[model samples]
Target: MTASPPDNSAQMASPSYRLAVFDQDFLLSDSLRGVRFLLEFAKADLALKAWGVRSTVVVFGSARVRENGDPDHARWYAAAREFAALASQRGGAFLEGGPVRDNVIATGGGPGIMEAANRGAADVGAPSVGFNITLPHEQEPNAYSTPELTFRFHYFAMRKMHLAMRANALVVFPGGFGTLDELFEILTLRQTSKSPEIPVVLFDEGYWRGIINFDEMARRGMIAQKDLDLFGFAETADGVWQELVRRGLKPHEDLESLTKSP
Candidate 1:
């Protein structure tokens, strides 16, 4: 065989040639997409675990719900805030300062109910988690979340995984598509036995019943009637906490009284 032409691989190489793993160009390539996905999962996992977040009470709701300015907005926002504070105080989040704790409030990390819940945790001097997603519009980490515990993810799947993987309970406020998607995702996981039993409390029975006709679906033979027991309805923050406790949630010893402090 003719001698190969003078090799120019070194000359042709770019910054990607040395320390390829650290090269942004190489890392952003299609071939590395899977690696990127794993990095997303691993980054959040390590950070949360390191922070001693053993379990979370995930709050899902509409980013449109406001703390004021409208009737529905006021109702949902207040309920979410109260619920988050209750969960942090009673759900083992502050029971001990160690490598494992339960019921740290976790949110989608955007405005509206997410902000309200995160703000509620902060109100009680508790650290809360925010799994913010990189969205094209209207999605950013609210200021209330603990800075170190707040995480941003480019993939919804990874974000959802982090949301569900450590959830001890789920409190859903009235929301649109995104909220429904997350609620059903967890429900499906529980229904299929992919995840352990997660107490799901849907706030505002009227709102949810209007949006989703669970009874109708069951009557029509779409979903099993027993599926109705998968979740419960509540109108107030205290009701949500009570329902969770009835479903076998154990509160921290310090939470002997379930009264909401004024």
Candidate 2:
């Protein structure tokens, strides 16, 4: 069950019906049931509110992807590191024409590429944001997160909702099934127009090519050529810059369409 589903949204008047969705830490801190808890979390969504949020790029990759001293692995890690630095720069390549500098790096709050991205941002003296998962593996929250931005989720779907809640774009690095699952989820949302439109940049062309056979799917007409345009590629920070600009960067945004009750 997704932690803290809005199951109590309508029946919030009954105090006796309150249900705790988190451990004492989260439950006590964030509260549960009633309009108070819902209002607070709702404000959280509105407060960061996309426009006020630190302009950010969501970075995804495998927790297992490692950097060995081997040539290819070394090159990949170095490139990933460099890419993050550029993206985090104040008015750097990723933000060349935008008002945002000090772009916050957002990650899964675990090891491997997520840690690498957060670490890379930290190298520049900028702390990243980690939206951690509360899984059995217990993805530990990384150390690079800014105190205010670090968060943990009891539900993968909830974590994902938060991930996209303020994301301006996506920079997916090499990862496995988890990564693919996330990629497909975001794509499916975008394809169906269920979620707000955003750019998704696939990092590491070599890894992407080796792992997924999008071409074969295309040949068999399992997917359309136009559908393939849903995502672009980036190998170096420079390439990422080209695409971000080409796409006409949008604000790291949030939902403004929900009708306000008069």
Candidate 3:
């Protein structure tokens, strides 16, 4: 009997035959979640490193704030924008062709306060980072952040990691649940000594006090009195910068001088 031609079509068409790297279905599977996380971390990390971002001043606030909204919202947006501009100009982000960039303005990369902050940095001709995230409602990145530095992530944990890792300080503006979550995350990290000490400043003392009774928490033994000192309050953009300095956020000039000293 004559031998029939060998059949190889079935094997070639099998899913198992696809290359792992190119197989989106396999890569997105639960089994590859760790890899996905690593990818998320590495992409941003590499870009920041390439851009010489040694340190960042993280800005967090309500995405709902509008420049033309109610009085409180307008004030918050204006302050956030002003603060970012000031930080970028004096924090070494304006330095051109430097091997290390310090205290570059960074934000959540959404509308409202995030947009204001990014816009402020852009106003000063400085590069700013926008660590955006994938959300059910689709949060889009504002046009103000540096295009090269804007990044989007699928995981909040990874996004938060990037935000915290390079932060030399954190400035929080009036916000809601998301803002509160970020504020406490850093506070918890500092409280537990999981990260290096960095100054934390909340904009609009009245707003924060009204939203969360932190003093009550300390009085009720929910947190130590020292924990209450983890953050200070500021009313204006300039006050925010002053509070950050008072709380130990160093300026780029000081840092540069220190580097040159014997």
Q: Which candidate is the best by lDDT?
A: 3
lDDT score for residue 221 of model 3: 98
Candidate closer to the true structure by lDDT (higher is better), 1 or 3 = 3
Residue-level lDDT of model 2, residues 128-149, one tens digit each, is: 6777877876678777665566
Clashing pairs in 1: none
- Model 2: per-residue Cα lDDT at residue 238: 68
lDDT of 1 at 37: 98
Rank candidates, lDDT, best first: 3, 1, 2
Which RMSD values do the candidates have, in order? 5.9, 10.8, 1.9
lDDT of 2: 0.67
Pairs of residues clashing in candidate 2: none
Error of 3 at 78 (Å): 0.6
Model number with the top TM-score: 3
The whole-model C-alpha lDDT of candidate 3 against the native structure comes to 0.93
